[model samples]
Structures are given as structure tokens and as C-alpha cells.
Target: MNIMKRFLKYTALTVMILIIWVAAIFISMDKGWWHTPFTQDKMPNEFIASVQEELQNEFVGTMAIALFKGGKLAEESFYSNDKPADRNTVFQVASLSKFVSAIGVMKLVEDGKLNLDAPVSRYLTRWRLPHSDFDNTKVTVRRLLSHTAGLTDGLGYAGFKNPKDVQSLEASLNKAIDADPGSDGRILIGVEPGSEWRYSGGGFTVLQLMVEEVSGQSFDSYMQSEIFEPLQMHSSFYQWDENFQDRLCDFYETDGSKAAQRYYTAQAASALYTSLADLEKLFHLFDEDNVNQKPVSPEFQKLMWQVEAETLGTPIYGLGTFLYTELENGGFVIGHDGKNNPPINTAFRYNPVAKDGIIMLTTGSTNFATRIASDWVFLQTGKVDALLFTMQQGKMIQIMAIGSFFILILVASIAFVRRTGK
Candidate 1:
């Protein structure tokens, strides 16, 4: 009987302690002391609901949507598989890394560490930009960043998958540019720098080389420490190491079939893993007057929003962010989309005017996803001013479960005491 009393007393104390701990957690969460990620249930806006519904039925893969109004999260929702997509569900962002790389390079420009007009050959000690009989010195950092360096995208891909075991940037450039694949692999200057608007992944890669040379740091470390960490984008990082493979969302072919994993090492122009929630924080930079507790001076932020391409006849390209100036009714937004391996299409767009935007990471890289994204944009635009409200529905469920366990334990303790006492 004495043993039974001691057992009940211990059990009661344990249960009470657990209850207090759970209550404290809830209280902290309610007070925003904990990083309680917001889901669609907490979304207050109609725009989020519209996009969520569209993506759920049309988009075949997992996705997360977050909408911002005046730099604040107006609506947020996530619909995925049995696995929930949160702020940490890292997905391969592919070419979107180019945008990030561009930012790093621009920071160099801002610091007066690199010259936009200076020849890239000035920094490179080994092989220079492919001259092919033309002066390689003509290729400048500005030209490379704008993809106007007369380089082809094919050669960029070839160099990335170059057969030689070249560890240094100089050795990589010395590699032969394959001409058989197509003229895209050809690196000779086809036109004057800054004369034409071409999407050259090769040019971006060269920019990566320039960044490495100027900053005196590897591409991965520089961006992680300089840009991502400062922005509080904890989920953003380079795609390296087999350990990260576990957190990776599975990639699919354009047809929604699973794709074989293909690894590449050139990180500057491509290869980044991030989550939709993290992307939203990145876009928030535009809406805010400060980032990382530092004042985002009007002049500096405008440089990011500045139209770098007057010759292209539009504001489609900015410093690091793409100028999405063609939204139907909504004002202009600065954003970019990424496609790396086939079937892994990802995109994030933000509108400073409406202060609303959407971010999606899809495994299947199909035009279908793009179409779906366009439709979602239109749907969200209709309900422009949306509202969201949420109560801790899960808390009630947790409370019930905890209460039931406490009751069961109490009854068992009472019965044990009676049996032993009698």
C-alpha cells in the first residue's frame, strides 16, 4: 500500500511537470517567442487561398505559397505530401543561384573592390576569357553580369561538365570549349560586349570566377556568409555533400517521372538549395528600408531595382533581381525563376506595388507549372485585399491527448492503490 502511494505521487508529479512544460511552450508560441512557422491555416488573406486551391489541383508536385502586403506576411499556406513543407524544406533552386551570385558581385561593385568596366583578364592569373583571335580584354565584369559578353550558354554548360580535373578557375578556362555540341559551346566573341542581350550561363560562370578572384573567397563560402546569413535565410545554401541529400526534396522529370540525381560543382551561376519561406524573406528586402539592422539607403536599394538594360528596350533585368515589369494590372515586381536539372522548376516573384507575391518550388520542370503559376497570379490579383485568421486547432487536439493520458494514468494509479491497500 505504501509503494502504491509512492508510485501515484511520482506519476502525478511527472504528469504535472509535463503539463507545465507544454503550457509554457504554448505561451511562448502565442507571444511569438518561438519560431512558430505559419501555415495556410493562419493565412488571413483571400489571395493565398486562391493560389493554394489552384496549385493543389493543377500543380502535381509539392509547393508552398506566401503572400506579403506592405512588407508583412498577409497570407501564407503550405500544401504538400505527408511531409509538411516549412521554412526549412530545402529544394534545389538551380539558376536562381545566378541571381544570388549577381548580388555578391554587385556588393563588390558597391564596395569599389571591382570595376565594371575593367577587363576580367586583369583579375585572372591563368587562362583568360576565350579570345578566339579577338581581344579577351574586351570582356568586362559589367558585360558578364548582363550576359552581353558575346559568350554562348552552351560553352558555359560544357565548361561546368568539363572532362579535365581542373581545380582552379584558371585551369577551367584553359579547357577547350567544345564546338561539336553547337555554336553555344563556342566561346569566341560573336559581337561587341554590351551590344546584345543574351542569356549566357557561361557569362554568369565567368562572373563567379571574377567574384572568387576579387573577394578572395570560394563561391560557396562568400555567398553563405555575406548574403544569405545577413538576410536571415537559414535554409539557403549551396548543393554539396551527400549529407544534404537527405533533406533534398526529390526531383522529377518534366513528365513528373523521378529524375536521376546529377551533380555539378560550379556553384556561382547555379546550384543552390532553398525553401519558399526563405525566398519570401529575401523579397521582403524590397519593401523594407533596412536589412540585417543596417539601413537600406534609398540610393543602394534603388541600384538593385535600377534597370541595367536600356538596350534590351525594357526593365526585365536589374542588378541581381529580375525586373518583372509586365504583370497585367499589378505594379512592377522584382524577381527571378530557376531551372537547373530537367523537371526541377522553381520560382519566386515579389511585387513592391501591391506588396504581394508568390513563391513555388516544383520537382517537375514543365511548362505546365509555369502555366499554373501564371493562372495563380491572375487569381490572386482578383482578390487583391485578402484576410487571414488562425487559432491553434492543434493545441486543442494536443490538450485532449495530454488530458486523456493523465486521466488514464490517474485511474490506473487509483486502481493499483486500492488493490494493494485491500
Candidate 2:
């Protein structure tokens, strides 16, 4: 009898703890713990409701949407994770790392420790730009930011399988520079600098080395001190830790895992974990004054915003961000898309004029997902897509809802039976 009683007691305790845990997640998600003061959530309640309903039907495993106006986060909501993803849900934001890393480099520029026009060799003493007939000296910092440094995005770093897969920064850079000319390892200034636009992930890796050399701190430490911490992006991180592992959402390709289980040594170019709430603040910077006194003057910021590349009298790439001065429909966009490692798709599309933007993070990547994103972009331009407000319950939602339903059933059944009837 005592054993039976103990069993019931322990079981009740376990269930109660789980209920508390789930409720905490729900509350934190509904009302975020970390955020900036808001004017209004950019998206209206009706709009959020409509989208939230539709998100349950989407293909992505986990996702969140944040809307901001003139630098204040207006509305934010997350939908359906295999694990309930609240505001703290973290997704590996692939090349988005470049966007953040560039901020670090710009901080160095603000400190007068680096120059945008200076050759990378000036700071990255460990490994210089590889020899090509192209003048390495022209491979300046500005060119790297704009991806116009005549460099090709070589076979970028392999996703590390484990700690063994990681390599020292010096060794990795040196290998790239020292590889045989025709070998797959070599990354050189393949074209004349200032010739054309080429998206080079490798270029950001170079910037990573440059930042480390100039700051005299590990790349992670430098970013923490300069960008992440001051900005209060508390959960944003480059390397894996227990907290990250607990909050990490799963990623999916069409049929398999698109995200690598291992980490990358190229921390600057890729490898960051963050959330929509945190990212909303990062995107806010494009629209608001740097409240943190980010050292750079307003004029210098204007320089960063200036499009470095041009065609037919139109501007293209801004510093680390892209500049869409004019769209085909006569609208404008000035943000970047990061389709880093597979299955993890993230984006920040800010409308400078409206001082509003979409901060999207998703752990699902597929051809259909791309189409959905396009529809979303068009929707921003006032094109109507039927996606918002429709509920297409994903697996996670069905399971969580079903379990909650069972719990409700148990409670109701217990409450209805009188002691005499029992």
C-alpha cells in the first residue's frame, strides 16, 4: 500500500512539473521577457492572428515573425516547434553571421583601429591574400564588404563534424593561402578588383581574420564585447553551449536534415544562434539612431549605408548589407538574406523609408519554402497571398494540442463526478 501511494505521489509530482514547464513556455512566448520598448507591434493583432493561424500550416519546423516600425518592435509571434519555441528559441543563422561580423569590423573602423580602404594584409598578418596576377593590394576592406574584391567564394569551410573538425584560425587561413593554385583549397583574387560583384563567403572569412588580428581578442570575445552584449542580444552566440543546445530548434531540407550537427571554425562567416526578438533589435539599427553610442558618427554611418556598387545609375551593395535603392514596383529594400547551412533560412528585410521591416527566422528550407518567402516579400508590397490567417496544423501543433486535450479531458472528468456517483 505504501509503494502504491508513493508511486502515485511521484507520478503526480512529475506531471505537475511538466505542466508548469509547458505553461512557462506559453507565457514567455505570449509576453516576451527580453525586448525593447515598443510604440506598437508593427503588425496589428488581427494581422498577427491571421499569420499565426497560417503559420501552423506552414512547412517549416519552427518559425517566428517580428515586425518593427521606426526602430521599435511592434508585433512578434512564434509558431509551432517540435519543441514549443518561445521568444528564446534559437536558430543557426548561417551567412547572417557575415551581417553581424561586419558590425564588429565596423566597430574597429569606429575605433580607428582599421580602415575600410586598407589592404587586408595590413591587419591579417597570419595569412595574406593568395597570389594571383591580380593586385592583392587592391583587395581592400571596402571591396571585401561589398563582395567586389575579385575573389570567388571558394569551397568554403566544411561543417565540422566534432571538435576534431575545428582548426586554428591561423592554420585555416594559411591553408587557403598556401594551397596549390589549381587545387580546390586555394582562394585568390580571381578577377581584377573593382570589376564586378561576386558573392564571396570567403571574403567574410578574411574579414574574420582581420578583425581577430586587429582586436587582439578571440573573434567570439571581440564580438561579445563590441556588438552582442552592448546590444543586449543575450542569447546570440557563435559557439555551442548547454543553453544553446537546450533551445536549438531542428532544421529540415525537403526530406532530410539540412543543418549540420557539427560546428564551423569560420565563426565570422557563419555559425550564430539567435531569435526573432533578438534579431528585431539588430534590424532596428538600420532605422534608429545607435542608442549604444556605437562610436561611428552619423556621417560615417551614411558612408556605410552608401551603395558601393552601381549599375545604370543605381546602387547595389552597401557595406555589409545590401541596398535595394529601387524595386521594379518602385519600392525599396535594404537588408540581407541568409541561407546559411541547409534547412535554416533567415532574413531581415527592412524598409528604410517606412522605418519598418520583417525579421523572419525559420528552421525549414525547401523549394516550396523559397516560394513562400517570395510570396511574403510580395505581400509586403501589397500583393495578396492567401497564406495569412489559414491554419494548416504541423506535426508539432497536433501533438501538443492533442496532449493538452487529454489533460483537459482528465480534469473535466474528475470535476464532473460527484463522490457519491464515483
Judging by TM-score against the true structure, name the best candidate.
2
**Error in Å for residue 270 of model 1:** 1.7
Q: Report clashes for each candidate as comma-separated counts.
A: 9, 7
lDDT of each: 0.59, 0.65
In terms of lDDT, the best-performing candidate is 2
* Tens-digit lDDT string for candidate 1 (229-263): 87787777764646655666765655556655544
TM-score of each: 0.68, 0.71
Candidate 2: 10-residue stretch with minimal lDDT: 384-393
Off by over 4 Å in 1: 1-45, 56-59, 81-84, 132-135, 154-186, 294-298, 310-312, 326-331, 372-422
Give the C-alpha lDDT of model 2: 0.65
Candidate 1's TM-score: 0.68
RMSD for all candidates, in order, please: 23.6, 20.4
Error (Å) of candidate 1 at residue 141 is 1.7
